[model samples]
Each structure stands twice: as structure tokens, then as C-alpha cells.
Target: MSGFESNPFADPVDVNPFQDASITQATSGATENVGEFNPFAGTNSGKTIPISAASSQPAVLQTSMEQSAQENAAAGQASLIKQQEELERKAADLERREQELQTGMENNWPPLPSFSPVKPCFYQDFEEDIPEEYHRICKRMYYLWMCIATLFLNVLACLAYFTADSASGVDFGLAILWFVLFTPVSFICWYRPVYKAFRSDSSFSFFFFFFVFFFQVAVYVIQTVGIPRWGNSGWIAAISMIRVNLAVAVVMMVVAGFFTVNAILSVILLKMVHSKYRRTGASFTKAQQEFSSGVLTNRTVQTAATSAASAAAQGAFGRNQEN
Candidate 1:
């Protein structure tokens, strides 16, 4: 038998496995192929790798990147919400401040100054200031006031007349009393009633004013006649004084002119007022209704009623206590 064909039961012979030339040649060739390989070589130029394969990213790393991106988006959204809240807070603060400022401005006591320090007594354009409907009536009222004020001149004239003649103290006193009593009385009784009558177009008020003013007009005529010891210098007195003393005559004439003005104005105004009354169709009956309504609704009437009630209550209480 040959050595290569030894039986399995026989003792194994120690031999060098490296002594095989073919195995040594195969290992040397594999080493040479590995040493000759170069990854940086430019021969594979046109070949494209899939983007996913070229990146060589792990699945865990990709998932973590996506989660980080989601987290960043959430943080950005939170920051935007915070900014909006901050802007809203600022807007609310500004609105509050504006409201406070407006309230402070509106609550100012003791009102601000007017455009002009002094107010005008007389309106420059009478027509502009007075309503068109009331123009004529208001003008008459103004004229009445003017006439009343001019009576002071009459007093001066009368005093002058008395000084020139045997002026009695009683006459002078009567003149002063006439002025003081007549001026305000005329205003309160005649002029104001007429004014209100025309203003309201009330028939009753118109009739009332007509009656009172008729008497006033008669009084004006009498005053103009210049009766002796009266407040006025009548035409006769003026003429008589003219022959006596030129200066006295001049003063008397001036007073006569004022009297004449008052008389003529009163007559003309009376006619105008009559025409107005006719146009208005105001009657005494309607005037009475208006007066009744006014009295019923008047604050003064209400106040008087309240006072009377309280007084009655107090009196009843006192009587009860006495009983």
C-alpha cells in the first residue's frame, strides 16, 4: 500500500500543509488582486447610484432627523403664538389708555372759556338775529325799550322846566315816581304780554295784550299832551315855554319829540299788532285754553302745590300732637 492510502485507524503522520504549491499560488494571487484595486479610479464615470443608497443613512438617524424637524416646527409655531399674544396685550393696553384719556377730557367741570370774554348786548344785524316771522314784533319791542330808556331824558327836561319856572317839589316827585312805576309796569304788563302773545300766536294773550296796550297807548297820548305837573312836556307846554325862554323851549321841544316818537310808535305798532292778530286767527277762547294748559304744567305751580301739601301735612301733625 502507498502512504497516501493509510487507513483511518492508523496513527496520523505530521506533515506541513504549506508545502502545497497550488494553495500558496492561489493565496499570493488573491493578495496581488487586492493590492491592485483602487476605489478613486475614474473609469466608472456615467454610473449613477440611487440617492438613498449613496447616502448610506441609517433608518434610526432618518427618523430622528424627522422628529427634530417636527420639534423645530412646533417651537416656531409656539413662538408665533407668543408674539401674537404680546401684540394683543399691547393693543389692549393702548386702547385702555385712550379710553382713560377720553373720560378725563369729558368730565371737565366749570366749562372752558368762551371765544370772546365779553358778550354782545345788541345784535349787529337785527334781521339776522331776529327770526323772520318775529322781526317786526321784536323791532317794536326794541323800540319800546328805547322809548323807556329815553324817558330819562324826559326827566331831565322836566327838571329843567321846573327849575326855569316855579317848579313844585310835589311835581318833581311825581315825575320820578311816574318814570319808576311806569317803565317796569309797562314792560311787565303790556310789552312782555304782547311779545309773548305774538310769539305764541295765542288769541287770548293777544286780546289781553291789546286791552292793556290800548290803555298804555292812551297813557302815552296823555303824556304827550304834557298836562301841567305831569312827567311830560305836552305840545302846549313846549310852545308856551318857547315864548317864555328859548333854552326852555328847546328842552321842551326835545322832550316833545321823545313823546311824539312814543305816541307814533305805539299807534303804528298797535295797527301792526291788530293786523297780526287778524292773520293769526287767535281768539280769546284759544288764549284761555293755552293759559289753562300753561298754568297746569308750570313748574312754579307744581312747586307751590308741593309746598302746600307739606305745610298741610305739618299742620295736621301739629293738631294730632295737640289732641
Candidate 2:
């Protein structure tokens, strides 16, 4: 019993009967490895265990975020610069177009037939020669000139009709002369000057037109008054004819109405032209400068001036010799 019973002080022994030497050796080797293992030590195996580099992650992420922010900012700046440049280019193009429009372009006026012996003396295209702002007013001036010419023709016809009854051959003859003389002269003096004023914004032309057209307005008023024996079949003349012949009076009254219309139109056109002139940025000084320059540059004026100077110098020398 003593031999079979385990003693408390005695060493413990293996009780497994199926255990082999190889198994025992393996178990003992595993036990030895477990005893030598250190949890904190680095691996001895050729392959190392992977660890998360979480300590460096925030730094790398911060650096990448900074770089990305810089790149985004650069992209935004580049886009802004490009947009600014595009705006500048468009603005310059608009300015260039405005300048070209203001300066005007080539003209093709007085649209005449090629076979006609009479050549067009003046350029008269409203679209090509005049600015958009001045087109309506300029055309109105042209129409006024036409109306005036038509009125003159009507006056001539009325005078011829009056003369047929032996009323006054002088009036008829004078009407013809007035028609022929005034038609072309009025065109050259007032109409052409106003046209040129609008076409080139010429200060001199504006001044000339104002001067001549004022006198023209006065003439229209005179003609409207129908001063007897002055060639105009105006109110007085028409009223006087009523005593002689009713039909002649009626015809003369019609002519007088035409003259009245001409007078009214002249006054209205003068006001219109003046308003346009006010907006043209023209001045008396500028007109003077232009006149001076034009005169100085003219070959005819220069030649005449030179001849006058030579004559004066010769006269002065002769006077000096006499002295």
C-alpha cells in the first residue's frame, strides 16, 4: 500500500502509457521553445512580422494634404489669370471697332450711269459717308434740297402761266433766271456745306452752312411775302391777281403756298442742323486752325501768296530805292 500510494514529498512521474520516445522528444523541444520565447523581442525568422506604421501616418497624410491644397490653389489662380486675359482681348477688339467706325470708310456716292457724259461732282452716300447717329438728319437735309428745287420749278411754271395772259413777262423771265441761278447756287452754298459738315464733322463747313443757310432762310421769307415784281408769286402777288383773274389768283396762291412751305422747311432745317452741329464737338478755334492749315496746304493759295509776297517785296525795294 505504501509503494502504490503517492507520497506528497515524492517527485511526480509521467502516467501516460501510450507516449513514445519521438513524441516525448517533440513535446520537450516545444516546451524548451516556449520557455525561451520573449513576447517583446524581434523575430529571429528570416521573414519579419508586419506592423502598422501608424505613428508616421498622420505626418504623411498632413504633407499630402498640404501639397494637394497648394496644387488646388495654383489651379484656381491659373484659371483666374486666363479669364482676365480673355476679357482684356475682347475689350481691345471693341475699342478698335469703335475707332474704325468713327473714322469712317471708303465711299461710293452719286450712283451715276457709266454711259452718262455728266460725271458726279460730289460724293453723296449717306450710309457710307455719314455716321449712324447722323443718317436721319443728313437725309432730311437732302430731301429739303429736293423740295426746294421742286418748289422753284413750280414757281417757274406758275410764272409762265401768269405771263400767258400778258400779266408780266418780266416776272416770267426773272422766274426762269432765279430757277437756273439759285438751284445750283443753293446746292453748292448751303446744301453741300451742310452735307460736308455731317460727312466729315468739318467745323468750317458747319460755319459756312450756318452763314449761307441763314441768308437762304431770309430769301425764303422774302419769297413767301410775294413782293410784287420780284419774280415770286407769293401772298401779295396772288392776292393782287384776284382782281384780274380768279383762275390766275388760284394758281398764284398755290405757288405762294409752295413758297410758304419752303420758308417753313428752311427754318426747321436750320434748327435741326444747328442742333446737330452742337453735338459735333466742333469749335471756332478748330475751324480757324483747319482753315489755316487748308489754306497753307493749298497749291493755288500758296502760289497766289508767293506771287503777292514777291510783288510786295519788289514794291518795297522800289520805294526804298526812291527814298
Candidate 3:
């Protein structure tokens, strides 16, 4: 026991001994410095220390960047969704308009034509057909054009008359006379006759106007040139220089042209008014009256008429059946 206890300096009995103090001191110094003067300390000594937050700076920065990216992605998605919704809304509006237009088209469907080899040249498509109102407008435009042309020519005739000479002198005196005469005649041919024909259906009026106006056009061309013995005194007198009242001739021509135009317009308006009067269904006057009377337009009268017609139709059908 004494021998075992007294071996202090007997080659250290192969026990592990301290090698170098430098490495140990360095490791210990490093640990001590980490505890006391750590590089990641938010507070030191008397101040509050934040260890985890200080160490986690790079990680937090990375996380912050990730969150910011996520927020941007969410905003982009929201914007995309809004755009899609707007597109869908626009599409729905277009669809609604399309459906409404289709309904309107179907409601105004024209009657189907019977199969014929020789089809008449008429409006045959949905949108290609011209309305009667459009035709009337075209007619009005043509009439206005004719009125303007006639007015200008009448002014010219007045000029020619104002500078009076032998009807043979200026080659235009006969033109002036013929235009003045034909102004009234043209009214009888085209405007006045059409007016009367439109006012009250006259079968001959159409035929007469058609033929007369055709002749009037020919006369217009011939009359524009110098007349060869053809005017009031022209038909039965020797060629002589008859000095006409220049101002009076022009005034008379203008007055005659205006009368012709006025006659045409008045007749057309009268016929239009009369025709509109016949279509009781489209009577604005009736509508206005009903509106002023504060009575909602009632279908009672229409229904009564329809019922009477239906009853008559039914009675006729029953009689035929019995027979």
C-alpha cells in the first residue's frame, strides 16, 4: 500500500500529461472573450444584451427579403385578378348587347319569299333593306337638288332678260323665254301632277306625268339654245328687234320658277300629311291628344275591333263548316 502511494516521480507511469499551454490558453482566452466581449452583443456590461437577435441578423435580412418578395407576388396576383374581372365584365356587356341586337333583329323578321327562279331585285338581307323613311328622305334630297338647279337657271334667265336684244342677238334670249314658259309647264308635268296623284290615287296621273316630263326634258335642251321662230310673238311674226323689259322679264322668270317650286313642295307636304293621316296606327296627333288628356293609351279600342273581326271570322268559318 505504501509503495503504491509513494510513486510521485517514477516516470509518471505513462499517464497523459499537459502537452502545450499555448493551445489551452488560447482556447480558454477565446471562450472568456466570447462570454465577456462577444462580437454579437447588442448590450454590454450594465446594458441589456441581445444574443440571438445579434447572431440572427443575416438570417433575418434573408427572411425579410423573402417576405417582401411574397408581398410583391401577392400584389401582382391581385392586380391580375382585377384585370381578369374587368375583362369578364366587358365580355358580359358585349354579350348582353349582342343578345339585345339579336332579339331586335328577330322581332323585325321579314316574310320568307316563295322559291322563284327569277328573283326580283329587292332588299333581301337583314341589314341591306332600305326603309321607306330612307326612300322618302332620298326623294326629298332629289327634290331639293332640282329646286336649287331651277332657282339658279331662273336667275340666269333674269340676267338674260335684263340685257334684252333681238332674240337672235345673244343666242340665249330664246333660252330665257323657253325656261320661263316651261317653268309652269314642268310643274304641270312633274310636280303638280305627282302632287295630285299622291293626294288621291289617279291611275292616269302617273302615265301622263311620265310622258309629259320626258318631253319637257327634250324641250329644255332645245329651249336652252336660240329659238328658230318660237315664242309668244315668235310663232306668227316676222323677225324684228322687239325690245323687252329686261328687269320685268327676269322678275317674271324668277317669280314663275318660285311658284313652280312652291307648288311642288306644297303638294308633296300635303300628300305626305295625308298619307300619314291614313295610317292611324302611327298618328302622333292621336298620341299627343292621349298624352294631354292624361289617359294612358288604351288598347281597348284596338281589342274591341280585333274581337269583332275575330267573331265575324269565327261565324264565317262555322257557316262554312256546316255547309
| Model 1 lDDT, residue 204, Cα | 68
Error of 3 at 134 (Å): 9.3
Better of 1 and 2 by lDDT: 2
What tens digits encode model 1's per-residue C-alpha lDDT throughout 107-187?
Answer: 222234467555432113334334478777767665775588657777777777778787534445667888888877886
- In order of listing, the candidates' clash counts read 3, 0, 0
RMSD of each: 23.1, 15.2, 24.7
Q: Best candidate per lDDT, number? A: 2
List candidate 1 segments past 4 Å from native.
Answer: 1-134, 239-244, 309-323
Q: List the residue pairs that clash in candidate 1.
A: 204-287, 225-234, 226-234
Please list the C-alpha lDDT of all candidates, in the order they appear: 0.75, 0.81, 0.51
Which of 1 and 3 is ahead in lDDT? Answer: 1
Tens-digit lDDT string for candidate 3 (47-95) = 7648987889999899999999999999999999999999979977996
TM-score of 3: 0.24
lDDT of model 2, residue 22:
83
**In candidate 2, residue 323 scores what lDDT?**
100
